[model samples]
Target chain A: MTKSKLSQQLAVDNLKIGSHVYSSRLIVGTGKYPSEDIASKAINSSGAELVTLAIKRFSQQDAISNILEVIGEKKLLPNTAGTLNAKEALRSAQLSRELFKTNLIKLEIITSSENLDPNMPETIKAAEMMVKDNFEVYVYCDRDLNNCLKLEDLGCVAIMPLGSSIGSGRGFDDLDDLILLRNKIEQILIVDAGIGVPSEAARVMELGYDAVLVNSAIAYANEPILMASAFKNGVKSGRKTFLAGRMSRSKSSIASSPTQFLK
Target chain B: MSRIKIQLNGTVEQIESANLEIILNTFAPKDRPFAVEINGEIVPSAKFSDYSIQENDKIEIISAVGGG
Candidate 1:
């Protein structure tokens, strides 16, 4: 039997987000895992084409070797975590580029520790510098439509708007803002951080977000593999629903039985 | 012979070595980057040349990986 036209269209149109091409627009993080093995399994199950990692001190006693080995040829995205200024972010991005051997950098500049709120000014500045330095910048910013547009103007390949505070597990609080940002920004719109459950991810994708990046939720789950699978399904379902398009909502329900047809 | 034990890829192993760099050179060549953990603390890559290993010392090495 021939497939539906919607499915055929979706199959033909490839979703392009920045430099990365994804059949499934879900990005996962590699942190807070019970074990490296579980993290690897979870990531593979999630079907994420891109992943995030922080550049920090690598210890002699560290157990990340097996994890690295497991990752093999997958894309490694190094983030500039805890950088409060543009200079620090730039330096971190540069170092990560050398260390991870990838041009993709998740530009994160924090202003306060309470909420891990990103400093928009610094983030924009750092993004500009990284772009000029020939790096693909994914700026993690608050759910501010204006700021998102500004970041897009700064030449960021992707604008990662937070669903909530980083690692808060609160999920998407500003759905309106995210929707507006999605409508305004031409670049890739990714919801990064604060996604507590698969529903949150589904909600973002349903709202037409290009992708979602999650870390703590999967990493800290009781069963990382199960949670990862959940996320993977949620993202796929959401993207499918969005592309399928929904019927227009009306306050009054349309009766299935037509009054004019009644004898 | 003094037996120096360190965690290799998260597994404990013992070797006989007097110099730290020699042992590391024997295991991980300088060309590659690996995070070395001694006991529970991580030894910075920059200090690998200077850091010495003693008998029964636990070491762990982790490398940057790509996934997800």
Candidate 2:
């Protein structure tokens, strides 16, 4: 491998937000599976080291004890999914830390239900508080580069900029913004939400993102295990492609015509 | 009756009698994310029937919701 290729590999390898090491560079969630068994199988098939779980009321019930038991060996990441303010986000972070025994948190402070857009001020406040409390914060922000930079400045260990919106599956609607965010932040940059298919994940990886966090895309698939495997392969292939260093694009077509014969 | 002790997901607990449902119900109300580990082996909630508790058998009920 060339120096640039080696660096690219190292960059992919270094996407760990805290103590977790994920080879696939794609983190999945366990929420939307039809059953716990299927969810467990999908998670195992995905080969994701870290998995996200939205902290909700059902978690407190005993009905899902079996599900929790199945995922005992994997790292459980709790998200502040429904939290609207900094206080709620902080409380959720604390609860997650207490329940999951891990300081890693995915900060999601939504300001509007329609767009599921992040409240920048609330997200910044929550990030500051959670980081101070010794949590490795991964803030999910808007696709705007400015919001991502602001979150990075607030001490977030990683910045998860959305591609469109949660579960939109639109897939990289703003490539320029994502590229700018990747360039501006020194910390980990993960493409979270709005990814609809495996190719979207591959595209994000190809764009030099550190990782991709997915949930509904895989969970809602008709064949989740197969989709999980597809995502795993896509992420790996995309990372490898980025490491190999893609050729620069040309404005005009360079046809391989018989130039020598013509001359 | 002798004291039947077991490990619940790594935590040690002593309960009287070998009734599985009662023991599980006791710990269920705690609202902690846990899994039952009996005698160094994981006992899925579905298989709570095949194995009966013996005296002094270490039962570990591991809780996922622990302080970071």
Candidate 3:
């Protein structure tokens, strides 16, 4: 291969989730926006090819404008966010498949209401059920390498590890674990949740993660549209930096000029 | 005309008939995409006209909502 061609491939390119290829590596969500107008605008500014959504009972009062109507041409990734057990998660997945007409399902089962941490056992069960049902599962879990590996073995299309508790905005709690997971797994790694700013998103991408899913960060920002744009640039910059390779850390200062100066 | 009572999104509602299509026309927004489930079984939109709802059948009409 030509040097330029090979170098171009090294730079972060399109993202592949399951069989579908997307141009953007950042995935935004459609929740917590002041209005549907802002949400659509933010998503558009983010340049996200895929967006996350939830399945809820239809309510005419709240249905003045449908969420599907605003989000045009982007792939929908329906998540089982409210489910507490494997059974509920499975039901949500099934219903999402029918509603969105897509096999992509973000499996998130949280047991505790306060922490909103993933119920690993329940997530596993739901992943198994989703796999059996022929859905492309993206399992969300803590930054535990073992758990992520297990999900990969279950045929999950993606492994989404939380940077911290969902929506806490605490940022990455353990950088070591994240780097370790990146080194250990071959499946698509997406750092989901707790990304408060563009820098956090960039850091995750710099660690060689395939993608970063930002929701509350952009939605709650003072300017959702602007924050969305910032995140888009952040993800791209970090990916390019990663491909360029960073300089090694040094304990002692090294002189860039001649050691001896003319007296 | 006979009426049937069914649970709609966890609330009991009285409808004129047991037909799924009529019930949807009354409750669902025609412009949006939605999925119907009766007693935990998904009824495809194409089958709505032919499907009959049983008494006390738990029905849920759902659509996409904002979430992350």
Candidate 4:
């Protein structure tokens, strides 16, 4: 192959988030699957380098879950799923550090359960604390450009803007706002939450997003294995398209065949 | 011994116990991986036997569940 083609392939092969570099850009979450076996199959098939799990009380009554053992070699990202404020989120983070033994924390602080939108004030406060602790934090936030910029300045590794509310299955129609945020931020951008299908994930990647974190959509699907494969392909196809660039569209007739002779 | 009330993972329990280890023995199964926090301070495993539990001291035994 040509030198340019080989070099371009190598460049897209590695996705860097903070100090963590991964070959696969898609990050899967270990939630909402019918069972652990199904979750394991889905995760393994998804080809995701990093997987997210909510850190909760470790009770003996609860079935023991060795997710680290299940998804072998994949980075275990512990998130503050149920935290409503900064203090709670920080406590969860500190505790998770002891358990997971990783500095990476996905800061998820939500106030309203109805829409499950992230609390900006709480998220910002928690991000500051995580930074001070030298934790490589990924901020789960809204698509607001200003909030993303603020997080980027505070040494966050990646800025994860929700496609919509968490677990809504609602697709992001406000592509303009997302575009604005994407253009404004220099940090690695990941569209987390509200992805209903593989197409949604593909659309986000086609818009130049670095990665996506999918859970409910795939996990809750009737056929998670097939869905996972679709997502893996979707992410790869979208990334390739983004690198390949697109042809301009026109309202008037633009013939693809024998246009030179006709014109 | 006069018992003290502490919230363990958000559950209120009246225990005759005086230390974190006694509390763990009361609630958690003997063989399990876990962590403890007393009023938001995570007490290391070694300190569980020595750290005395006082009245109304929010001692939380965080139990991890499988979730994403």
> Who wins the DockQ comparison?
3
**For each candidate, what is chain B's TM-score?**
0.66, 0.63, 0.94, 0.84
Count steric clashes of candidate 3: 0
RMSD of each: 7.2, 9.5, 1.7, 2.9
How are the candidates ranked when ordered by lDDT, highest leading? 3, 4, 1, 2
Cα lDDT computed for each candidate against the true fold: 0.77, 0.75, 0.90, 0.82
**CAPRI accuracy category, model 4:** acceptable
Stretches of model 4 off by over 4 angstroms after superposition: A1-8, A64-72, A259-263, B1-5, B14-19, B29-32
State how far residue A161 of model 3 sits from its true place (Å): 0.6
Better of 1 and 3 by DockQ: 3
Model 1: per-residue Cα lDDT at residue A64: 30
Query: Per-prediction DockQ, in order?
Result: 0.11, 0.05, 0.89, 0.48
Error of 4 at A94 (Å): 1.0
Worst 10 residues of 3 chain A by lDDT: A5-14
lDDT of 2 at A130: 91
Q: Is the docking of candidate 3 incorrect, acceptable, medium or high quality?
A: high
Candidate 4 C-alpha lDDT tens digits along B1-68 = 78788777777888897877877887764443566778889888888789898878887666444455
What's the best-to-worst order under TM-score? 3, 4, 1, 2
Give the per-residue lDDT of model 4 (tens digit) for A63-175.
45655556667787889988899998999988888766789999999876565789998899899989999999988998878888999999999899998878778978577
Query: Across residues A151-225, which tens digit of lDDT does each residue of candidate 2 receive?
Result: 787788888988887877788778898888777878889988888898888887888888898878878899988
Q: How displaced is residue B53 in candidate 4, in Å?
A: 2.7
As for lDDT, the candidate ahead, 1 or 3, is: 3
